[model samples]
Target chain A: MRNILILLSFMFILLSCSKEEKEDLPKDPIILPPYNPTYVDLNDRLPSYLPRMDIPADNKTTIEGIELGRALFYEPLLSGDGTQSCGSCHNQSYGFTDNGKKFSTGIDQVEGNRNSMQIINAGLRTSFFWDGRAATLEDQAFGPVTNPIEMHEKWPRAVAKINDISTYREMGYKAFGVVQLDSVLISKAIAQFERSIISGNSKYDRWKKGEYQMTPQEDYGRKLFNKDRDEIRDSLGNVIQVIPGADCFHCHGDLSDFTDNLFHNNGMDEIFTDPGREKVTGNAYDRGKFKVPTLRNIEHTAPYMHDGRFKTLDEVIDHYSDGLVHSATIDPLMKNVDIGGVRLSLSEKAALKAFLLTLSDPDFLDNPDYSEPPPL
Target chain B: MNMNTVSKITAILMLVTSLALTSCSKEEEMGCWPPLDVPGDSANVIMIFNATTNGQPLELLKNFKDPLGRTMQVELLKFYVSNVFVSFNGASTLLKKAALVILVDPNVTDTTKKHNEIALKIPYGNYDRITFSVGLDVVQNAGDPTKYPSAHPLSINQNTYWDAWGKYKFFMIEGKGDWDGDGTLTNIYGYHTGFDECYRSISFEKMLTLDATNSNETLNVNFEVNDVFFGKDTLDMKLHPSWHGDINTIETAFIISDNFQEGLRLN
Candidate 1:
């Protein structure tokens, strides 16, 4: 009887202590090993001429985060039907674009209107999309996944799906120090991976670095590309000698990214088919204007322009040569719009094409790091 | 006293002494200009640069008749302001430590946009005159913009630099005009001025007061677009459609620069 009483007293004291400890426990316990991420230095990856990337403080690049993001980017589990991923549209082999396709087919087998933009040096751009709607890479990544026409998956559903997987939960913990995966963390990881996609090595880049020599034709083409429109006029204001100039340096300046990163009509339309930037700013002056893309991998990113109207590079050059259609919002920099276009001769056209091909970065397309990762 | 109690009292006294010493040092450092005291010697001033046409705030892309009565619409008008100096009692002081370039973009319809506003904090006094350069200094003009931060005004991403010419465009004015007044702006004209020779320094003579009584004050300066096109020298848009900082348009760019310098007035 004495032993039983002693045991009961001990059990009662233990239960009381357990209750007190449970009440003392913190509502949200502090995660151990704190939230320290290994930051990446882009100077080693990017060329010297390219400007420093403006990375967000909140979403600094980390090796762990990039690894998680690369896996997520290739995982078809992000899509509603589990048949598509970001890599489905942005294939590394095709310069991060749909190979030869004008528009990427979504998970619903529906074709998107705008072309899948090549992701080369995308971290340097101020805006995303053809219309410049999304302001940052994070904001851009938040799109597509929930876009009904693209991934066709709701944010809640996507988060639930990701959380269901143990590998992703582990990745989430490693990347963000959080076990509960959400859209914000996912977008940040994807943005870090996208920022890691730096492409500067090209034939032209090699030539600029004195590692490769340009052919005579390519050199002549480069000169024409930089030359200002000079019409040796007679006393009667008529052309006497044609000092042929393609004059492409203004909008597509050759300083760094080969893009001015500004919106332009480019005299491609006479009517409003898709009011590109006007939809965003709601200004009449912005009507028919579209964001100028980088010409880094112009050779691989076929079916060019916002709508991918031109099927070939020759067709694109031809459109700029004589097929300019004027609108009210035509960029004043399009100096040759009144004369149809720049009016490039056959030899000039071929040479310009050759020069554009030099912009193709073979190493970028074959970069194993950018390729889809194996199963997690 | 017991050792434990004595140790606790000693620790408390040490903490108090350290805090007292820290406060004493801070108070001594702040004796000349106390932290609690309101800074009556300095005042904040806002310099507003506005783009106007004939005393009216210019709305971008809106059709307006120039002094020549040519129907024109300005698509873009951006310029850089640097080397600001203020003179008080025959003594001049440079406002900025370095060549701080402020790109004034007057493209917004909203007149209160901060793009064209320059805020300064200076000594509270009556200033006789204010002088400022309308373009970048020689060193800043030649400096590689890629070295600057992305958000910096002199960043390469601003798309104002002329890489081929190896100089920045100090003044960029792009527009279209209907010379015949047929309601169609068919003619395009871009008069971009750059290079060291075209930089203009303008002076405003006025009794500008930045007294303690008026800490937050605003000074409005207007850039007359009509005067720029037809003020000093008439720019024939038909003859010279564009002046893109090339060797062929250097003379015309200089004339345009002079016209721009002549277009400023107290609004």
Candidate 2:
């Protein structure tokens, strides 16, 4: 009986020590099992002329994150009625824009005034949206999800609904090394997928790489697009032939992405009904200003302008050529504002349009990777 | 406690301490300018720039009279300062590298007014003069912005690079005015100075001293914004409301670049 007591005491001590060890363990140790995701070097896929993307240090790009983000982008459960998704408004065929619609219709059947911007080369932009409202893509993702006229869903409910799905819970764990998903993680995933929608394989890019040659009209249009309104001169300082330049490069000159990523009031109207960038900056000087969008894939991403007023690119060229209206906050780059426009001749306008079409990349429109995934 | 138990607790505490220290290690600071080696007991030098128009603080979007009495309102002003060198009796010491591009924009908000100032550390001494350039050297001017970080001044994100022309705008002055004395400001003018021919080197001869007793010193530099439009030749706003990279206006770009040098004074 004495030996039995001693043996029981030793067993109790061992049990107590083991319990103490268990208590010492972390309360919420990160278990990343089945979460070994492959890191994606986004620069490897980007063009050589483009600069490195400013990816957040906390949210590095990964295959698992992109896949999860793609799913969430197409997930209708994110909306209030489970009838709308981000993919519904931002279709893949029309360069991620609403299909030839002036304004996008929301889940609530309400229409927004601003055109749905294309999602091409979004990773290269410093600011997002027509008014440059969102500073980062992650910040931009938070807007449409909760906007009353857009998705019309509350964040708490949306997060809860996403968390309720076991598939998303598993995907969230694999993508971000956590089982519990939040609005921040969801936005990050969507932004990652958006960053992957690159469009650098356009015909213009091919011509630049010497893989393809542009036609004479396209070549002439390229020269006109780049040339300023200033007159040409000879080496002897003699006045040479004056070329009617289109002057499009001043605002959209970053060839890698085809946008200077700056705001400008391009003299669209004398009095703005919607005060474009003023809402964001609260400055009178910025009243009519709006973000200068990239011209890549401009062929499919029409009608152009923030209002989507023009149905065809020809109307856009005509507006720039002969339809400018002077305003107080018009950009100084619009030097020909007095004449109402740049005044490009008919032939010049045709050539410019032909060159603009070279920016269209069929490969980007048909990429299966950007397509909606099968039901989870 | 028994010896075995005490040893186990000791190991646990050691592991916890190690993990805590590992997580608390300092992170390296990110930027274009890194801390450089300087002599012990170095003096602090601060370069202060005050932008003025007709001896008054220049305000953006406010109507002001030019030399020709034309009502003009300056909207934007930005310039580059590079290759800062301090000289003592013909011997020069480079205070900042050429690759270190410093952008000076007086239009910044009062909270960020320090953006117009530059700070440096040097050995205590009396410098006879200082020399700097208002533009980048040829090689640096045409550099690929993709090679630099986004935070760099020469990076594409800075919005100063003319990617279409493969060059940087050394100086930019954009504004609008009423050339015909109309109540409304109608004429828009922009002068972008760049290219190899437009680069200007400025020399300011002043007795600048940094002593051991007064380890901290400041040098004030003033730029008269009015001189940009009035100095040497009165810029005719009616004939040329804008100057771009066009071959006809290249001379105007050069003239504006020269005027930028004329506007500087050591105070």
Candidate 3:
């Protein structure tokens, strides 16, 4: 009888202790290992001539992040319809530019207004989009996904879809230390991958280092392109002054405007239907002004201009040669505005075209690092 | 205690420790991040720059025969408003006193363009007057285009910062007019003003009271495009076809600069 009493007493005491322990314990008791992402130095990835790019401090680039970003960029799951990814418009072989199309067709089969910008040297750019509408790569990333004419996916739905995928969720955890994927982190990863897309090692870059020799035509063309304004008179009885050179350098940059990553009206139209920079600033002076693309890999990035109006390099050169449009906001750099164009001789135009071809970076177009990743 | 009882107690303690550690680890991941939800001061004043011809909203790229009887279409109209100081009963309090630069572009039809509305965060109080500069101040105006980050309002992409002259255009009003009244825009008149001499500051005695109770207050500010041209001192378009950041343009640029005060009306 005493033994049975002892057993009952022990059981009662154990039950009371367990009840107290339940109240004392926390709501969740799963010890997940702390995620400390590995950071990679971005400066190490870029050439010395180019300054280290400005990325958001919050979204620092990491090895895992870049890999996940590559996967997400190639993943069609993020699209509203499963037919497109960032890789759809941005092809790897064409210097990350869409192939010869003026306007890239969106997932909805509707055409976008402007040309799809090449990702080459994008990390070095101060603004994204030809209009300079978005200030950061991350800001630029959010634009295509939700744009009704583009991917057409609502960000929340996209996030929910991303959360449903175990592969992406694992990537998200490894990259951002978050189990639930957020738009901000996804954008950061994509931007980091994009920043890794660098295009140097062009014929022009090698020419600077004396690794390659240009043909006489290419050399003359380069000289003509670098031509600054010279005070001269032509036979039209109109004295043209103020605009000089082949007059390309001022608008283009030191390597000409392409490398400069600046914007200009470039005298494309007298009255602009599409106000390029003006659309972003609402300034009428910015009407018809579009960001000057780098001349690097220009051969691959044809149909040119913000609208992709010019089909070939010759068309672009011809426009600069004589198709200049006088406008209220036409850049004053075209010093010979009275006569309309630079009046390049036929041979000069051909040479300029030859020089432009030298800017194509084959290695950039073929690099496996920038190629589409395996299916996510 | 028996081995079985000891094992049960050990497991309970382990669970409690694990829960505490999990909680700590989650917080540890987020502890370094800047707080996401700190609110900003209310922006009380919403200034809208509207272009109107005789009380009708000015339509861009249209041939408008203004009250001055010149048949012209405003091809472009853009400027900067900066260094604004609010004037109260006796003293003046500067808003964004150091770095307040706002680019005003009234054209909104373009999908790519930024909207013209400016949301200003004025301090909590009452003010009967306001004062501001017509363009970017000297320091912000005169900088290497590459020196500043792209995100800055002053930093630009080659167009605003002219590479030829290496000068920034403060304000621009470009248009074509039929000076002969022949129904054709033969005369291309533009007043692209810049340089330190052209920067003007104007003040208006308009009653405004900003308090805690009132938020999202809007102020209707009219920018008469005509005031920029035809006033007491007028812009003689014939003498000046265009004045874009040239040393010789200082004389013509000042005439347009002085006219800004007359055009700005606080309704």
TM-score of each: 0.85, 0.87, 0.57
| Regions more than 4 Å wrong, model 2 | A1-32, A231-241, B1-40, B98-113
**Model 1 Cα lDDT, one tens digit per residue, B183-235:** 78888777778898888998888677777677787778787887776768877
Query: CAPRI band of model 1?
Result: acceptable
Candidate 3 lDDT, tens digit per residue, B91-169? 9765532222223233233355334555567766778888878766786566555544444344443245544454566
Model 3: runs farther than 4 Å from truth? Answer: A1-34, A233-244, A254-259, B1-267
In model 3, what lDDT does residue A44 have? 76
Across A241-283, the per-residue lDDT of candidate 3 in tens digits comes to: 5432365654454322254565666777877889888878877
Higher-scoring candidate on TM-score, 1 or 3: 1
Sorted on DockQ, highest at the top, how do the candidates line up?
2, 1, 3
User: How many angstroms is residue B221 displaced in model 2 relative to the true structure, after the best TM-score fit?
Assistant: 2.2
Candidate 2 lDDT over A238-272, as tens digits, reads 54765588888878876457788888989899999
RMSD after CA superposition, every candidate = 11.1, 11.3, 15.3
Model 2 has an lDDT value of: 0.79
Error of 3 at B237 (Å): 17
Q: Which residue pairs collide in model 1, if any?
A: none
